[model samples]
Target: MNTIEEEVPLGRRRRRRYSVEFKAQVVAACQGPGVSLAAIALHHQLNANLLRRWVEQAEGNERFLVARSEVSVPSAATPAFVSLPLETRNARTGEIRVEVRRADQSITVSWPTSEAAQCAAWLREWLA
Candidate 1:
């Protein structure tokens, strides 16, 4: 069954121990395109839940290893946050503007920027 039976000291209970290679093989099968995990588990004579846990552990370990390797590699081209100059406008003079055009009629509405919530509600009702 591709597993080793280990006898526990406490009782007559024996635990099944799967090799790393066998686990990797099963996990790879589960990751195949359009593959059913339950079907794979049945083929391997393993419980579906245990196979699922193996798959999760494999994926999590892969992610952790990848993250660790990335952190170890130092690249000059790696992106870093840089401050950029932004155009600043007076908030008191700012207006929430909306332009609506239908057929040949055009309407322009401007609301105070401070009442943005009310302007949004009004715009929603107007559009609806």
Candidate 2:
């Protein structure tokens, strides 16, 4: 009875309230390039987890949805890296040689650094 009486005076602590504009600013900082959400939260003396929730809420907003809908999403299946066989000649000579192997078939091509685009196009054509 005494403990209840004592607790009644303190009651529950009030929850912290933040303005929408402040939340939007923090969320925007989290989205900036090379910006860390935890660092931002620490700088602002806020909980990182709370900032992440705000980010989720912002992303789910109708404004974000409309902007996201305008951007094209790539296919889930990304292109695999092709095995690029490298051959090096003498160190004195700076030349590039790329070899591709498919089952029993193999191809060898040598190109100067300046003609890399042509070499890439030729490789693509040959592979196709």
Candidate 3:
């Protein structure tokens, strides 16, 4: 006979340590095509917010590694966006604007709506 136990999120539970391999796997899965972070986290039995934090850490580490102690980096990571207090329901449709420069040309692209997952995926691919 097989018995299954349900997981319960306890209050102030003990800290769990994840291996580098496991973290890498989770990060990669979260960045995979058509894969949402929430879905990946759920599938791996992880907290979605924790996974997001890991992604931020991984991205920062990746940047440092790429620089290889040659290039200087800022002391603080700047915020990618700022909040606006003014609000208008009669405003134009919102779009996430993206600009990419390569070789001698620059291209700007905009995506309609606030589709964060799609934006993240596009940015990852474009930067890679």
> Highest TM-score: which candidate?
1
Backbone clash pairs for candidate 3 read none
In candidate 1, what are the lDDT values of residues 45-82, reduced to their tens digit?
Answer: 99999999988887789753344343333222535689
Off by over 4 Å in 2: 1-12, 63-128
- Give candidate 3's error at residue 124 in angstroms: 42
Candidate 3: residue 116 Cα off by (Å): 36
Residue-by-residue lDDT tens digits, candidate 2, 48-74: 998898889888797754544454443
Candidate 2 clashes between residue pairs 3 or more apart in a chain or in different chains: none
Worst 10 residues of 2 by lDDT: 1-10
lDDT of each: 0.73, 0.68, 0.67
> Which candidate, 2 or 3, would have the higher lDDT against the true structure?
2
Residue 31, candidate 2: C-alpha displacement in angstroms: 1.4
Ranking by TM-score: 1, 2, 3
Residue pairs clashing, model 1: none
TM-score of each: 0.42, 0.41, 0.39
lDDT of 3 by residue, 41-120 (tens): 89888899999997788788975234333433223334567888986432476776777889999999877666867988
Choose the strongest candidate by lDDT.
Answer: 1
